[model samples]
Target chain A: MKKLHYSELWCSSPRYWGGLAALTFIILLGMAAAYYMEHSGHWVTGMSNQVVWGLPHVFAIFLIVAASGALNVASIGSVFGGPLYKPLGRFSGLLAIGLLAGGLVVLLLDLGRPERLIVAITHYNFKSIFAWNIILYTGFFTIVGIYLWAMIDRKAQKFYQVTGFAAFFWRLALTTGTGSIFGFLVAREAYDAAIMAPMFIIMSFSYGLAFFIITLMSAYWWASRELGSHRLEKLKNLLGVFVGAVLYFSLVYHLTNLYITQHHGIERFILLDGGVYTVMFWLGQITIGGIIPLFMLYSPAFSDNRFAIAIASVMVLIGGFVQIYVIVIGGQAFPMNLFPGKEVVSSSFFDGVVAAYTPSLAEGVLGLAGIAIAMTLVAVGARMLKVLPESLEDPEQGTA
Target chain B: MSGNREQPKEIKRREFIGMTVLAAGAASVAPGILLTVAHATAEAEGASSEVRWGLLIDSNKCAESCNACVDACNRENGIDLLQRPQGQGDEMWDAQRPQWIRKVKLKDNQTGEVTNLPMMCQHCEFPPCVDVCPTAASFKRADGIVLVDRHTCIGCRYCMMACPYKARSFIHQNVEQQTLRSPRGKGCVESCNLCVHRIDAGATTTACQDACDKDGHQAILFGDLRDPESALSKALREKSSRQIRADLELNTGVRYTSL
Candidate 1:
């Protein structure tokens, strides 16, 4: 194979500074919104006792799950030994770290007492899935950091596979931990299942790959560089397979829930009368996120169309967000069955009623800030380091 | 390091008497307001696991219109004084406010039988809230009173999510003049600590029990599970009572009859 050349995006352009400036502004806005919510109290937001987590969690979790998936490129190159994917490894590692940092920032800021973050770190309850996740998340950063060094630095190149393999397993555990955050909740009918963990793994694969493809295309296009169709087709096919896997897992989750009499209520709510959640599941996750992407990727007419593949990737990302909203918010909206057969004739705390949540402007801005922060890190990292490769042409067909 | 060169003289007899009078006057004016002290004193003897505290309620005798226990709990915990934000509606504020206890009305599906009961923290032997709390802020005392340590609580509200009975409440807004008994603040999860202050002070009963007795309901009973002679234990032995969501096998301290 021909040797791959890597270089930084030129930093002198007006567009580069302009984009960075825009990202900085959004980060500041998000910080300000966080301060307003903290100072005025959570009462200003639409979130209540009923729905403890809101849009911020949805954004944070989606980015975190995608972060785990983003490292797949490096895993394929170093662990699985895919020659075409090896050149994209460095940037993939960078994107994974940047996305995780962004997600963590959003999650920490959304806390009721963000200042007590130190307490959460210090006070470890081993039984809690959340405490274990804290270790997994931090460990992921360290392992991925070493993995990146192994891939980039020539002297440390020998350790690439060792570190990559370790990272591969760590990221899987991290995603499983994330999925179990919901799965372990026996109180909520929607999440108490073993399928949630594996479903999350499948989702990470699809969402992470989608995010990686989009970032690669956008960065290359902006720099006026050629991202070869040969490489794009390989990524396109992998993304299609992951998306199909996600659909299969989702189908299994619903089918399994449907089979059980206890879970019938939650299944009905999501598949039928959950209103926005139902729309998000069918249109956002299934149609736009899954079915359409599969069609565009596999169809003979659009098989080679790079634009169609990119569009599919974007759809998957949108679908990923919709899926999270449905899981996090929709699950909470359904009332807990405190009394099995009896109806709650009256309750002081809006019991036995569907809880309503409207995302406020502050929450919306905070969610955007998470996206902007991730993109900014990616933008700055690309400009500063020799991450992106010159081309992905095979040695036999160098002219192509 | 050995600075015993000049020992200071003690205060004069007149100064001592004047200081004593001043302290007495201050104590009289404040009545139970020792601002620095927590209600549940950090006494040398911590709560004992041997003595399991619980509440027994006979819901059949619980008057439908009477919310004495709810009112008493609110007053004792300062939940009543919590103010709604300026623009929010009454219904919105009511739905969002911290509720330590509440009156719930339930109707059966088949028999169309109706019942009313005051519900609070079940104080389970194996609390899901305590189990899920990442910071260990939501903890069960040795005496089986599940309470939130506001000092350490990061207010993630995972406890609220884990609770099956909807017992825990998140403090949504800051309160100015909180009662000394329950100095609640914003950004923390809290629930009925089973009147831990009273329990710790050796009061032998709770405000809700007192209020119920005063209202002539005699529906609520409070005592220790370890002591078989306790009124609560005797009532449980005599009456056919059930724990809410007994299928979970949480072994709740609170039991209700005629539900």
Candidate 2:
């Protein structure tokens, strides 16, 4: 593949056309859902007070983390001076912006007082994690955008140098803020652990790397089939490493929780006794998210396959949904105030003393609707803004 | 700067009128604005900060048949039966129930049995609801009563997540949950105020406490916690009282003794 510019790839290809169409369809559906939710006043969605946040909250966080991860492609290679890793830099930055915007869309839809969201900026509650999250997310998005554009602008060379280092820390802080929203909720015994904040950070790394690796490996195909193959191997190896880390962190997180008897009951309620939630945690996260991806990544024959990496990315993403669910929904399922008394541990699971929640269809659809909106917007963005680069071919070192 | 001050006398008359209007605006907003925390403190001109308010209810003295406290609270708050949130049953448990008073069956360790007692907001010293509230709607007074602003409440119910007692309730669907009063709407959070409205009128106790007295059992006591002479404070000094879910570390105003 010869050295290429943005115009060459902007020309429509089968992959681009299909991707754009699918994305547009999803976004249109999301807009429809949002309209439905607004008129329905939240009752249209399955969300109840018991399960206050469902798919939208989890997916929004996922997109944010993924967005940060996408930025890592550029920030890592550029700011950290990854000389060999420089080839994929701008692509990462562009993807980062797209994903962040998607995350924001989902988040706004979930907010109880949507119109007053801006009002959140004016009325700051020092202790409120939700308020802090709004600032962190917006700030991170702006910095990532400026840093990326600075990379392209030959006129302003010095700005990139400052943003180069600043962007990495800014992204990290964004993920940290996201985690603290749940981690600092001392009242929710499930999320009370300090480890959760850091665990969530690690999750961002896993999801980010897995997503960026798959996207990069796939995008490289635009240059030619041969170019993507070599890059695919590099990404496959990186993903293997990331999967191992995700598994190790997940094990440590739960094991440490179990090491103490105090958390054992709730932990068991999640991992063991927590029926549907437990199955989803184990199957969606542990098996598909961890074991299957881990096994496939390790198997050279399978890991090298382009199809396999895509499958793994999808699996890992789905697994992330379960990971968040086990914490947020699983946490709420347990009685909110567990400071025990002669509390009747309700003999029946649903009827038990512990609070139980099941997502209604409205709840589930609203979540799906959020995803559709994000995909559609990103697709349209790629089309309108020329966010997708013209070339996937990497020029030799020092080539203008 | 010196010349401006001399010229201000001519303009001062206009400015004074403007200032008066601003003060009037402040006065109107102040009672409504300082609502989250100030109700208890606002009434405390005669009282002091050291004077904490607490409640003591003896379950043995409480008769299960009588719920005069519930009736009194409902009547006082103008909470009609319709506006009430689903209690422990309906889907959304974001603290929407507004009877403010409740009859719960808590276990008795000595008898190994469930005992019936009326319950309401504990009004904790370190109110979690206030801290997580995005708006300053949920707040605690210096005198230790936790209160909510009905007008400012966006009804996000983040406070519901924070409260250990699960004392707060959301007005799900609409305010018509209360049949007798003005419809408050679906999205506002309402809870036991410790009857701040009556307190402003110089009432010695809440409607619930007064109703309890009328019931003849004298099972409940409400008073200033600082004055040792108050029945509640004296009872606290005498009998060991336990707040519901004591492990939560909330310095709750609600206390009940085992039979």
- lDDT for each residue of candidate 2 in A123-198, tens digit (9 for 90 to 100): 7677777667777877887887788667766576578778877888888888888777777676666777777766
The 10-residue segment with the lowest total lDDT in model 1 chain B: B1-10
| Per-residue lDDT of model 1, residues A4-66, tens digit only | 789887745777788899999999999999999889889888898888899999999999999
Instruction: Return the clash pairs for model 1, or none.
Output: none
For candidate 1, the per-residue lDDT at B88 reads 88
Query: What DockQ does candidate 1 score?
Result: 0.71
Predicted model with the maximum DockQ: 1
Evaluated with TM-score, which candidate comes out highest?
A: 1
Residue-wise C-alpha lDDT for candidate 1, range B66-178, written one tens digit per residue: 98999999899998888878998776687679888889899999999999888899999999999889989888899989989888899888888888888888888878768
Per-residue error at B87 for model 1, in Å? 0.5
Give TM per candidate.
0.94, 0.83
Show where candidate 1 strays beyond 4 Å: A394-400, B1-42
